[model samples]
Target chain A: MLARRVIPCLDVDKGRVVKGTKFVNLTDEGDPAELAERYAREGADEIVFLDITAAHEGRATMLDVVRRTASRAFVPLTVGGGVRSVQEMHDVLRAGADKVSFNTAAVAAPELLTACAERFGSQAVVCAIDARRLPRTDGAGQTWEVVTHGGRRATDLDAVSWALRVVELGAGELLVTSIDRDGTRSGFDTELLASIASRVRVPVIASGGASSPEDFVTAVRDGKADAVLAASIFHRRMHSIASVKAAMAAAGLPVRPVGEAVA
Target chain B: MTGSKPRIAILDYGAANLVSITHGLAAVGADVVVAAEPSALAGADALVVPGVGAAASAMTHLRERGLVEPLRNWVRAGKPCLGICLGFELLFDASDEGDAETLGFLAGRTVALRDAPTLPHIGWNVVRAVRPHPLFDGIPDGSYFYFVHSFAPVPADEGVVVARTDHGRPFVSAVARGSLYGLQFHPEKSSDAGLRLLSNFLRLVAANAETNARAGAALGSEVA
Candidate 1:
């Protein structure tokens, strides 16, 4: 049986790892590669490096960050943000990233997904969709709208429908983040995650509002997410990965045992 | 000869990731070399074909460099050779995804799994050994191996399959016949189980090389 993945996401800006509340007012944490190596040592299944910088300075710094992190990190690394072209995707992959994720760039040009899939194989391209629940119009039904440009602009695209389309466009995995619950420290929006996971054939990774180990359990067990991505809880050392896995094991979720620690 | 390290050759057709594969083999204590030329492969005790990217593109690189015939000759010689993922699929008759021509060393067709549960079967999957083979010596029957692929081989001769795994349903996950082996999983990324598998392959390579050398010596004595 395949084990549920536990991923720690690091927000990188100008090549340094940073953390902020609701994607605002960021603060530096440490060297991206050092932090990534620590997470890898602590039994993280994968690490996601999101370049939160604006598009003007280019994705060069992020590419260098990925190369540095990939040298120290043995587990799979996912690089996202400002990934606009096939050349950028190829550069990140060549720099040792196992997967390159696209958010704004993918939505801007949908055919980029197909072209990337054709070139790098679908498994290497991850389509990240950030969504937030909107006010009900029919007086009872709420809608999930796709948010782009780092959750600044709301598109007419429905999250669930767009998820299916992206899969058809050859996205091997979907990283769905709930903007409303992001950085809230409450829990994952299981309902929203389940809605998208139910519709898509590919693996869905649930991100945002994972404050505790129970949240991760809920995301995998109830939400049926293939993986759970968290930030604050891990970044601040609120809970170690070992403790989380121990909790997941106690809850009866299959997780790989942490082998003997290597120096 | 008994304690000598096994000399394994990783066939480099100008497109494969030779560095990573060499590092992985070296980590497991095997004496490895990136054999880019046909003659270098002959001197190797065992062969490994590691690759990334599309099947058709890799095949083109191999043929353009005039390596296809020598590789076929090496496999026919019955020396231990293992192919990873794309390398493994290329050993089959052909791939339907890109209509790519393969080495046809193994009797199989690599086809894409359509309308199944998932596209690329990424992450970990158990490689349940369905038949006994030397490559699976110490590896447990249900040991899990990491996989990342969209297409898999459907062997023309089913007898060559040594293991099967389930995604949508049970499919051939590994194949072995005599000294030839093909694994549809990335052993370098599989942690401990993967390292053990590589160790076993090294042992098999050394034993096969010894056997071949002895046979050659016996023939020489008979001729004299």
Candidate 2:
């Protein structure tokens, strides 16, 4: 059986990890490679670096960050955000990223998923969907809608349907973030996650609104997520990865043991 | 640190990402080289064939670079060689993927993973040793390793299989015969156990070189 993955997302801007980390233990929090190395020691199953950089010049610096982090860390590293073209995706992979996740670009041009999956196997291509629950105008029922541009813009596409379509288009995995629960610390939108996870056969990673280790367990046991990703909780040092894995193990879910001789 | 080190060649066919393997081998103190052409692989103590893209396209790239025959000859001569992921699948007789024929180094057929709940079995899973092999010398019996694939090879002779892992069904995760090895999982990304496994391969390479040199020296003494 595959162990459930616990990932810590690092938001990168201008080649440095953004200043959201509030933990005192993280020395040199500006360097992504250093922080990633620390996370690996803390037993992070994977690392997700979201390139929050805007300008082209900054993007090049972000690639350097990826190269450095990949050299130091051995676990799977996923670089996402602002990856708009196939060439950019190639650059990230060439820089040693194991997987690349696309959000706005995938929404704007669905064909990009096919093109990427063709060039760099589906295993390396990920479709990150940010969705929110919205009430129906027809007075019928509420539906989860796909939102993009950092959750500022909404699309007519339903989340569940879009997920099934991306899988058909050869998306090996899906990273679905609940915009409603994001930064709320209210727990994951299990209804939305279960809806999507059941409809698609690919592994789904549930992101956003995990404030505690129990929430991580709920994300897997109830939300049916194959993996769980959090940012502030881990960044703020509210819970260590070992504590979360212990919680998951206590909940009967299998997680890889940390500090058992892997560096 | 030493003048005489294990000279390792990492075969690059524009298929998979070779950086991780190169870095992993380097971390273990092995002198690594990324090469494509046959001449570039010459004078190397061992070779590593790493694959990431489609199997058919990987075979196309290998044939285009004229590396097929040379690779077969190298492994046939009992030289140390390691095949990873798609490269592992490429060692079989044929694959259902693109109906492509492979190196035929191992008698097997590559088929889509049956009953797999997921298409690409991504993430870490435990690998159980089926038989004692040097590739897993220091590694524990059920050490965790990362795997991402949609298909797995079913070897004709199961005895060559050194380890087994199950996603939806029991399948050959690692196979070894003589000096040729095929691992379905990515050891470079598997963290500590992976580094240890790569180091073991390097040790095996050095040991093999020593044994061959001693045999040649004994032959020379007999002739004298």
Candidate 3:
């Protein structure tokens, strides 16, 4: 059986980890490689580096960051944000990233998913859907609308339908972030996650509103997510990965124990 | 073998990513080289064929890079070689994916993993060893390794299979015979156990070289 993955997501700008880490232990929290290695040592199942860089030079620097991180961390890494083309995706993968995730680009050109998947296999292609819950009108219950650019813009495409479409477009994995719950510390939008996870055949990684280890458990049990990703909670050290995995294990879900002996 | 680093050459035949494997080996104390040409494999203690993608396209890249025969010959010589992911698939007689014929170093056909709930079984899964091998030295009986694949080889000779993993059904996850070893999972991305496994492989490479050196010395003594 596969163990549920716990990933720590980092935002990189200008090739540096964008200054949210409150690790008093780390000498240079801005260094992605250093921070990533620390997280891997702490038993992070995977590491995600979202390139929030906007400058052209930032792109080259992000590649360098990935190269350095892969050299040291030795865990599966998914790089998302600002990857727009097959060539760009190729560059990121070649730089030592295990997977390349697309969000805005994928929404703008869904064919990019097919192209990248065809070129690198579906296993290397990840689609990130940022969705904001729509208000229920006329007893419609609740539905989510696809949002992009960190929920700043909304697309008319329904989240569930877009998820199915992205899967059809050859995205091997889906990173579903609930914009409504993001940064709210309210908990994951399990309804939103289940709606998409149940519909998609590929793995769904739940993100947004992870404030505690119980949230991680809920993300898996209720949201039906194959993996759980969080940023602030982990970065702020409010909850450790070990605690989250322990919670999941206590909840009867499979999770790799921290400090598991290789022998 | 004792004092110097064992040089391991990684074959680069248009695989999606070779950097991780290169760094993985380097971090494990092996002298790593990203070799794209046959001549580049010279003087190296081992050749590692690492790749991820469709079998047909992989074979094409190997053919285009003139690596098909070199890789087969490397295995034929009983030299230390490791095949990873798609490279592992390429070792079989054929692949069900794209109906591609692969390097027939091993007697098997790469087929879709039976009864898999997911088309691409991607994640950390248990790798249960079937028999003892140095390749898994110090590694636990059922260590979780990261895997991302749809098909696994069905070896005609089950004796060669060293480990198995299940998605919906059991499938060969690792294999060992002679000087060759193969893994379906990406050890480079499997964290600590992976690094440990690579360290063990390097030790095996050094051990294999020592045995060969001793055999050569014995043969020279006889000739003398």
True contacts kept of each: 0.24, 0.59, 0.84
For model 2, what TM-score is found for chain B?
0.96
Q: Interface root mean square deviation of every model, in Å?
A: 4.1, 2.0, 1.0
Single out the weakest 10-residue window by summed lDDT for candidate 1 chain B.
B14-23
Ranking by TM-score: 3, 2, 1
Per-residue lDDT over A33-81 for candidate 1, one digit per residue giving the tens place of the 0 to 100 score: 8998788778787789988887657577887777777655556778888
Candidate with more favorable, higher TM-score: 1 or 3: 3
**Cα lDDT, all candidates:** 0.81, 0.88, 0.90
Model 1 misses residue A54 by how many Å? 5.2
Candidate 2 deviant stretches above 4 angstroms: A21-28, A136-141, A261-263
lDDT string, candidate 3, B74-168, tens digits = 89999999999988888889999999999999999999888776667889999998999998889888889989999899999998999999899
Itemize residue pairs with steric clashes in candidate 3.
Answer: none
Choose the strongest candidate by lDDT.
3
Q: What is the lDDT of residue A249 in candidate 2?
A: 92
* Chain B of candidate 3 vs. true chain B, TM: 0.97
**Per-model DockQ against the true two-chain complex:** 0.30, 0.64, 0.80
Model 1, position A213, has a per-residue lDDT of: 90
**Model 2: per-residue Cα lDDT at residue A113:** 93
- Model 2: clashing residue pairs? none
Q: Work out candidate 1's RMSD over C-alphas.
A: 3.6
Candidate 3 lDDT by residue in tens digits, A28-104: 24799999999999999999998877777788899999999988998899999889999999999999998999999
Q: Which predicted model would earn the best TM-score?
A: 3
